[model samples]
Target chain A: MSINLNRFNRVNRKKIFNRIERTHKTAIPQAPKRPPLLHPQLDISALTDIFLSKFSASSSTYQSIDCISLVPQLVLQYTELHNTNKTLVTNLQSLLTLDKSPLDWPDALTLSTPPATGEQALGLSYATTAIAETGSLVLCASKQNPTTVNFLTDHHIIILREQDIVPNIESMWKQLSLSAEHMPRAVNIITGPSRTADIEQTIQLGAHGPRSLHLLLLAGD
Target chain B: MVEHYKSNPQGSASNSTSGPHQTLFFKAQSSHALLDNTLQEALKKAKGGFIEKRSKAIADVENFESYKQQAQLVKNHTLDHLAYYLTQFEDNLIKNGGQVHWASTPEQLNNIILHICERRDAKSVIKGKSMISEEANLNAALEAAGIDVTETDLGEYIIQLAKEPPSHIIVPAIHKTRQQVEALFRNAHDLGDRELDTIAALVDEARLQLRQKFLNADIGITGANMLIADTGSAMLVTNEGNGDLTATLPKAHIVTASIEKVVPDLESASAILRVLARSATGQPITSYTSLLSGPRGIEDLDGPEEFHVILLDNQRSQMLGTPFEEMLKCIKCGACLNHCPIYSAVGGHAYGWVYPGPMGSVLTPLMTGLKQSSDLPNASTFCGRCEEVCPMGIPLPELLRQLRNKEHEEHLTPRKTRISLQSFMWTIQHPKIFYWLTQITRKVLTNTTLSQFFAKYIFTSWYNSKELPKNNSKGTFMEQYKKSSKQKKT
Candidate 1:
């Protein structure tokens, strides 16, 4: 049965490729003829500032915390401000990975579960990489970092190390390609919270995903 | 030939073997749409927003044209070697524990989906914006089979409730005003006696309703903006992130995509991505651009257990070698639709299909055959705005002209147009004779007003809608030339 299937595949492949031969110009992939974007020389700190401004312009908010201890304080500040009950936390306490978790984090945060639907008001997640050009957070799903925490909540908060910022999407893609074999289940390049302009071309935030995205940028040595 | 391809760009489930022959009424539909007060009001609100946002986004970018060139190059190269990249994508998907299915016809595609859903006994399915699914009429197929299907996108959900196919490629409910949406919500949602007049309330109501449906859905299906061959990733970009919930929350995820959506690598995908959202919604990037490769691995906390991708060729394989090949490069950004004056005037429903406007004009005829939707190709004024704003640099007007030529060759156009065009062609071939003949005609026209009896007969219905310009007393060009020569002699 397997041999028959393989033979079927071979013939099918032959026919498809033959169709391609009649239609296409057989050209190998080439380097881009010209650069699409000009990357101005901005040091890490300067790029961080640009990323912050771009984020705000895109309707996302951010704050630079002096230390890791400040994240819990920021969380309390947001929780009190928004009047949310439970906070969904993903990958914040994974021991297998070398990435550290918040040391004195409280029990207010929980893991993502099905159809808390609108019940889960606030979500806190750790960013894999922060893209500087578009002000996007690169979130990778793992055993600890359930991807649901990024989407299911009404308000989402992300923690990022300042050093992990990449200038462009291409730069990040190139880096990710190096570790191709160990790719996670999903990788989301998220810019702002959920939004839609589908109705009469009117823009609305938090259509189905989070209403607002808040970033807690941590300084790295 | 007339029966070969028919129906709207959004496929009808009834068009299994024999396609829907409904798109032939573009004339009657557009006429009615022109006078529709509600649609005109809706069009007004939706108007200028897309154009303004797009211009602002383009102004922000330094070298937008160069990016378009790069995108065109990427698409052209991938299309040339589509079979290779498709197989590579298939192999990678299989390796990542995802399944790939092939479908050549809409019937076959629908059957494959039904088989998968039946095997799992899927009760309900959540959907993202899959134009390919729309092309196959998947929702009709699923609903007919006793499966509850919900569209998660805010626009799609609104249109789905109203029992209307998407008028625009990107914004399905672009034809609907907020008041109409409020009425749709009041009628559809079980939460009755609720005041839902505002857009925010409508969004909140949908969010609450779809939020429950997403969690309980047995299967999730979505469209791909671009499928990455190297990584076996089906990337989707959306502002709402409903696609993310649909894919991650469901037990089984099915991707319904056209075969031409594939690109060579992530770099090429990024090259196109830079221009896609910038042109589509004028965002640097959407809220979410996800690369969901396969089913959940053991390391992942929450995602689908089974990942299936259905690559539907339909008539795209035949389109590959034809002049219509450029139509395959469309990313379905709706830029052409947004920029078109005819579309802005009549709205999406007037086109009478899942796809509308300039892109739909070329695609509807190509996909649904020249005879059934012969009016669509002629519907355009050849304004060239669609081509000017197109991110893929598709020659929309030239392609429309090719479709017109096909219509002329097939004798599908009206006898009057054929005779007029034939005469025009013959006259153009003989310039001196044309000039002499035009000199006599111009003398008559110069002596007469547009309201003349002969003018009424010549212009016919065209005169009824539009008044011609006043007569020119300067006589014909040949007479002027003769007078100039006489003056030179003096």
Candidate 2:
């Protein structure tokens, strides 16, 4: 009943390896590389105003607030407002911080990275809009940026630049293709949080992933 | 002792073929008694967990709807030309140095698997959770042939220890409580003084126990989620990674799957994967989605040497070209089970055979003879929930109704019930007689106390869980309508 492994050894290994290599090579295409820099000395107030206007179109829940004074306050409010479970906030805080015990992270999260420390959160970046079709997230994780900042946190606060919003999944794919590297190492399009109904169909939010998603659409300054 | 040993003359003879009504009545009573405690517990615990998790999982993805649609389209496309895809899949499997065996019936399938085991001199077989194997009763057949078979999936392993069939397709031990599991484990395995109170501990114990069997087994048996025709690969998606070990560790790996599992390519497989886990376990992706091609190559460090796929038709190919073809699109994700009210109440085993929930209600009578299992098709409330949540968009309620119509047309219904319905129909056609009969029945029931007693005793099944409605002493609505019409004419 045993198959002759020696017969297919050389040819099969070559075929499999070639296929993997080909897929990897063709996965990303070379593009015009740009420095990883946020636009400096930009009119933050004007950008915030535009973001707010777009936010109102998609969601009716936004309220007018002073951009300079209310930014941090609104962040806290939105975080609490979006998250129903208090435990998620605690979990997120622990995950976002560096030097946290690895055991505190869930199995799925642990598979991705070890627990993060407090200093690591300073390097994290966020993006708001992602194409709904292909499941590619608009993220800005860099070398100084630990991958854990985006994934490990219980509460993910994504501030969408109003102009960055695309029409559909195809548009997002187009945008992703414009990147210099062609494809990021990982792109997680998260619509919701970590959840499981395995306990008996009772959807306990934040089972193993983010329990809440908050979108801060900055409107006209 | 006499009561236990004596076979009642009224009882159905083991050899005699009886109508579905008699068989249903006997089996229903027996199963009711057997499942009373189990069903109550299962129903109470079935809801809340999976439902919430799925919604959260879907919420995480903005394009969950599109993914679901793509998955549905892929499944529909595959099912539309299943015959061609099945042939392609079989051919590819052969080309990859694997064997494909076709079985038209469960008996034939059981024999084919047993033959494989015998030829390989398989002493112990490690199996992943396979609903198809359950449908074929393969384990019993193997055990009967004096072979040791172990179910490796955590849920399947738990149910196997209890010597019971799977209660849920995804989580086979959905019905068993922690206490029940502790008792089962205590009785079956020697865990010493280790605490079995927590869910984690029980899972750990089962993992440790099954790990050894996975390493030692001569043969590994698993079910395929999708059989990719273009690539000659059998795809298995699991959260625990047990299926990977089962398929790779054993010397010979045997896959039991229906003919409709074939998909066109990896893209189609990926599309279906998006919905499969979300619908079943509410994960974006399962822990392992292993695509196993023809055994291990020389360069491969680990994998089975011999690969055999037993493609069991088991009435599925017959279902093709028929009105029931949509059923072939089922991926066995158990989403319908999670949403089904009846399955939520009675669980899988109460259906009295393999395959349960809405899918089982349609499939059982088709696989087993319609005459022997006619009640299953009629057992539905026709809520259409199963159809609503089905990832493949299978019109389950409509199909169930069609089967019911077929059963009625075939005269498989009991003679007494048929005659009663015929008389009722005749009375309805003759309105005067119908009204007169209705009034008389209402008057008799209202006036006589004995009538209530007779109804209570005679129609016990109807009144068992519910109180009888109060008798309508008022005349028929049609009679009153006629009087009003006459007055208007005057």
Candidate 3:
């Protein structure tokens, strides 16, 4: 539909335009100025421990499963600083074979793979916690590694840094604004595995996407 | 259509025995039996296709997150000033050569719609999938007044023929397997010896049947996803172009929508559009997202001659100043329902209302009255999955808890449960007495024979599917913590 752009006031329209421009220029603040990184050196093992602990406390019905065993490959980034341009295509191609070898699987699974194009793998960025309020994982998807990793894999494995966990949805917005320069293509706040109960009210997990989700938390890292 | 099913009475025997207030007790017993069957059947057939397709569609989009966030913000902003938006929407719609009707209750909405039907001398009306129309039971009302209304959405059409409410939001006939649907079609449509095994054939049959209704209808009725106050536009987002045709082909088009749908502009509408399709059907966008502003323009070729929007308040305006206002931000995406464990278990019909799932649980009581739906809030496992996936950020669990608190204050909880809680409170207040009572209970439970007997009779619900944890027979966790502290000091 063609909108009548002339109906809006020129001065008011300019103000809106100026605001948008200002927002674009100053969207992402420096890391230290933002919320402190809870566990700066959070790793896979520490994440697994926290996930098990949290899962145990929630329900007696849930069963614990090995998260790393489910992944295609564990890409341990030993970088001291954030790298936005590191591709993991060769590593992912090898990992896909390893991922297919597993026999028994968890009800939910997470996978990390390289972007379809030769873009840098969005390696697993850590959110402190998935918000209980909105089921959103507060991750800086701007880091190319994590962005590519989240989408390429059929299953998404997210490792949350314990200190980064926020209590509610409003805090997630706060964390996202902290780094504005490199907004990732997408920031998925998955609560559960992709599911649908459309067929006879029968919920089938992993219909078109990953049927499983595994959250690892690295605590005291 | 449901009246035809009512003739058997056996199917509705549970509902017939009780009034609306007592429906829960009947539902709880009958649905409890039905749930075991439904849940088992659901588990066997359950596979995650719908959500998977959605993820892939969303994964392809670069700006999907921004779209979701923008949509959520727009919905939040609109809901915050819903009263103002509704007024602006009503005013603008009237100004644009359309009529606006306000309905404070479902009864009023039904009467207003029927009055319009009567004035236009309408015999048949075509309808799109409208949860609000289901909420108002508009079809029954129209039918009771001797007007034939046909539901055109493929899923709704099947369920309408079966004379049952939709079991799921997006795929209304999701509960009916292909075999069950085949049986229903055979009986309803007189399809004798026709082997319709495939879903495509079934869809084609429905398409053929509904095409005539679309052309013959005197008026078309649909629900709006959002009503843009700035432009007097009513938006309908659908995978099929059925909504567009429903609104355009008839002489008069009537929209029935809750007041919360009004937004400020198209930019915000576009923002919401981003999330609505992805979260709902897992598509980048629905096949159709038609925005109709008043009737056909002077140069327009095909459109409704007369347009009407009936903004139903139906207790929504009452929520504006209250904490329940967050419920208004909902775009009816059904994401919460998809993620909800309780919804997946009992399905939508067991909730016994138009709206179902977590959102429905919160809304049914508020719109229907807390007295009628006291059990709705308590049905949740409080897994917090609904709140987690809700794009609009509705604090569902907190709302459910608040409803529980209201139920308690109103003495809506069962007397037995209240008495048990009261006794437990009394025991806790007296520490010495509580400790002694606990000691005796522990001693009794330590006896394997006694424990097994207690398991058999007292805690049947727990024993049915799961076993009780091995008790700390010696003492409680507090006692162990105290001993550990003493050891540390030493």
Candidate 4:
């Protein structure tokens, strides 16, 4: 079976290459340069504003914070408002490094970083980069930032530092390649909470992933 | 010849022997679809939403035309160097701890997947929306092997329960009414009068049911929107995060993609991304646009243990160096389907096969055979909405016209129609005879009694569905033209 499969692949590969080689010129055609994305030269403040506005256009909510310390308080407020459980799981290193002190956390709220199973209601992670053009958060998966945290939770909270905001997806890709050592297993660029229009074309949010997405935007670099 | 391929209700249940004869009998299928009140209601409800949303999304973009051009260029260039980019993609995916399997045909693709499943001892496989799998009838094969396969996407899950092929690419269950879905769910699930009254409730029910499947499934399969060769990542866009969950939660991950899906780098993928979501669903971007590279990293906390990508040629590689080569540039956004009058009127099922609508009409004949699906190319009204809306700028009408030419050349058209066309061609070659025939026919048509006699006898097929227009012209177009020119000269 393996040998037959190999022969099939080889025959196709040969046929395809020969066809393309015969048709294509000796000098390979270069990929055309893409025109610049929207507002390529916008300042950071303007970009953040655009990002937040576009993010709000989606069902997701956002808040501009002075620092990372304000995350837990907001999480508690969000949980209370929604009347969900007070349990929140996070893989954000800054929050973990802060370690529940100076950042006043309510005793009722439990916080821990474990691989998100179905039980986790809220999962917090940090975006490596955010695109202003589409209001998307780019999260790369690693040992620290598990891929499951992004999709497994019902309510996902993401931390986006102001400096991480890029003008467009192209810029975001450049920033990601420059920042990471190698491409992570999954680069999840999330734009909003999960939604579906499958049922008679009726748009419904929270199809299988997060019902709500909260972004705690850190104001400064 | 007409009887050689007939629509079999049991055709979709099997893979190997079941030909998609619905394509062959498209006229009958379309006429049948036209009268399906339930299907008509569903198609009516779906028709305007996609068009309105797509227009809004495109209007929001300042330079959408440039983006479309860039996307077209990227796909065209990639197709020209398909072998080069595919090799690069294979090499990079292997470097990223992912295995690449190549299959030249749909059977080979299915066998490769089954072999992988056998090796992994996978019992339950969760699949995201893969049109290629639908084309290969992978689920039927898996079930035949006694493996449990579940479609995780909401649309797919609904249709899977119905034991139907996808009516639309973006929304597989586009032809299914909500009440029909409710009935399907009530039958499929063992619920004691649970209320699935709202869309939200139905979605929640699917999530509740599929969650366990997500966690328990040994292998997950998904289709790639684009494959980045430089990074060895398969870019998947999903409004719901089912694709992400299906890819991440399972023990082994398999990406089902075509060879044309490969692009040179992340930037090219990004370029295509600009117009993909906007054209498909009228969103700036989907909720989750994941560039999944490989399986779990050595230091990663959680992901699939093994990653594999199955690249199916399936007559795609053969499309190269041909006029139909331009068809491979299609991104499967379904914009053409949304704007196509033929598609909106009859819906996708009438076209038959995995792909449907204008793009499907071009593709079904090419992938399947022109002889089998000869009617599909003629299904279009040549309104050209499909070409206008296609983001990749595929000349859908031209491709369909070419297919019609091929069908004509192959003598696949009906004998009576062929004779009429041959006579018409011979008459048109002689302008004087053609002019005289047209003048005599117009005079007869203007006379009500003669027109009625001709309509009943010679134009029976044309008159059956339509009425003769009220003619008010004094003379044939040539006579009028000659008279006006003569007066001007005098």
Best by DockQ: 4
- Candidate 4, residue B232: the lDDT equals 85
* Per-residue lDDT over B1-490 for candidate 2, one digit per residue giving the tens place of the 0 to 100 score: 0011111112223112111223244337434844588557656776766777677778866567677677777766665555556656766776767777765445556777777788889899999878778877778888888999999877788778888877678888787777787888899998889898866566656656776787689999999898877656687776554675677668899998876788876557767877787888776555345556676554343456788887765556556546677788888888888888777766666666667788878876776656666777866789988887787888999888877777787788889779999998898999888888877767667765756776678877766665756765465667678888999999
> Which is the better candidate, 3 or 4, if ranked by lDDT?
4
**Clash counts for all predictions:** 2, 35, 32, 0
List candidate 2 segments past 4 Å from native: A1-221, B1-35, B55-69, B440-451, B470-475, B479-490
lDDT, each prediction: 0.79, 0.60, 0.60, 0.84
Interface RMSD of each: 4.4, 13.8, 16.2, 3.1
List candidate 1 stretches off by more than 4 Å.
A1-18, A24-45, A93-102, A106-118, A178-181, B1-21, B425-460, B480-489
CA lDDT of B399 in candidate 4? 83
What's the TM for chain B in candidate 4? Answer: 0.93
Task: Return whichever of 3 and 4 wins on TM-score.
Answer: 4
Model 4 pairs in collision: none
C-alpha RMSD over true interface residues, model 3 = 16.2
Can you write out model 2's per-residue Cα lDDT over A1-221, one digit (the tens) per residue? 23333343334333322322342333332221221211112233454444344333222234443232333445445545654232221222222222243323222111222223211121113453543332223552233232334433455455444456554433443454422112222233444433333333334343322344455444432
DockQ-better candidate, 3 vs 4: 4
Candidate 1 lDDT over residue span A77-144, tens digit each:
78777777756554554322424664555666555443334567777777878777788988887765
For residues B314-381, could you state the per-residue lDDT of candidate 4 as single tens digits? 66755777788888999999999999888898988888788889999988877777767889999899
DockQ of every candidate: 0.46, 0.04, 0.04, 0.54
Could you say which candidate leads in lDDT? 4
